[model samples]
Target: MKALISTGGQGPDFEKVKDIFTHVNLVVAADSGLNRLVEWGIEPDFLVGDGDSIDTENVATKKYSYNPAPRDKDFSDTELAIIKCLEKGADEIILIGGGEGRLDHTLSNVGMVKKYAQISLWMTSKEIITILSPGNFITHHLPQTQLSIFPLDDHSGPVKTRGLVWELEHIDLNQSMSLSNRCVDSEINWEITQGRFLLLATYE
Candidate 1:
């Protein structure tokens, strides 16, 4: 199953986010992230978080599975939300979050995607971050978007890319450092034979 988790950060333009709704089987709101959904008039299937960032008085009134954790818990609201998604048998997760707010949260959210292969994509307010795990991915998002593809982990080697100005091929070393590459075609493809890497596509 595919799950969509929303975090309390800057939100993407609703018009640009319409396509993702058609692909998700589950929708989740992480703590105050519900506020963003409320703004968009989108209700989530599950609301998981510490219930501290938003108005707690109205939480119970919402018709959804509200799993509230202690505010002093070890996990973050976003992490808790992902755990909830995994418990529901979600094989793929698309995290909807913004790049604004706490910087640690932003980095940690991106780290979760890099650490866990189940997270295929993270659609932020500013960019579309794709985590590739040694396979092929084709995205038809934002033609000519400022794209930067690189291997976050050095072990990620032997990667191939198509439809980018600077395609990764016939390169030496264990990791790649290709940046400032734009989508040559409306549909862009990326493939890696081994290890993992991440691709950042700006919403420009």
Candidate 2:
């Protein structure tokens, strides 16, 4: 199933979430993420967090499953939510509403690419990041949207891209990045020969 994992923090507008809401099979909230979902009139299927930023009384009226952890746990709320999503047999996971306030937190959130292959996309209010495996990939966007794509690890294989202002063909992704390219076609495409790379598209 496609699980939509919402983590605490700001910058995940309703439009971004709504764009894929119909494709999502489940919604799991982490910590204050419940409040974000509630603001959008969305009731998540499960809630997991350290109970630091959430309101217990508000959750008591809900019927979804709740898994609370101690404030001193090793895992972050987003990690806990991911584990819960895995437990629910989610084959595909999309993370949204992650915090970019703290540099460390944002780094950890983006670094999740090294750990979870099930997570394919991250949609925030300002940016959209996608993980492309060894295959063909394509997505639509507004005209002239800026994009940057590269491998998190410096070991990705050759990649080819199309529909950008500056196109690429079979270039080593680790050695070169297609940075600051605008999607003039209102669509982007990529073909990966092997390994994984991240494609980041900024809305603002």
Q: Name the top lDDT candidate.
A: 2
How do all models score by TM-score? 0.86, 0.88
How much RMSD separates candidate 2 from the native structure?
2.1
Q: Could you give candidate 1's per-residue lDDT for residues 124-186 as a string of tens digits?
A: 888888776777777776678888766656577787778877777776426446677788788
- In order, candidate lDDTs are 0.80, 0.82
lDDT of 2 by residue, 30-65 (tens): 888888887788889888887788876658778887
Candidate 2 segments whose C-alpha is farther than 4 A from its true place: 170-172
lDDT of 2 at 14: 90
List RMSD in Å for every model shown: 2.4, 2.1
Clashing residue pair totals per candidate (backbone < 3 A): 0, 0
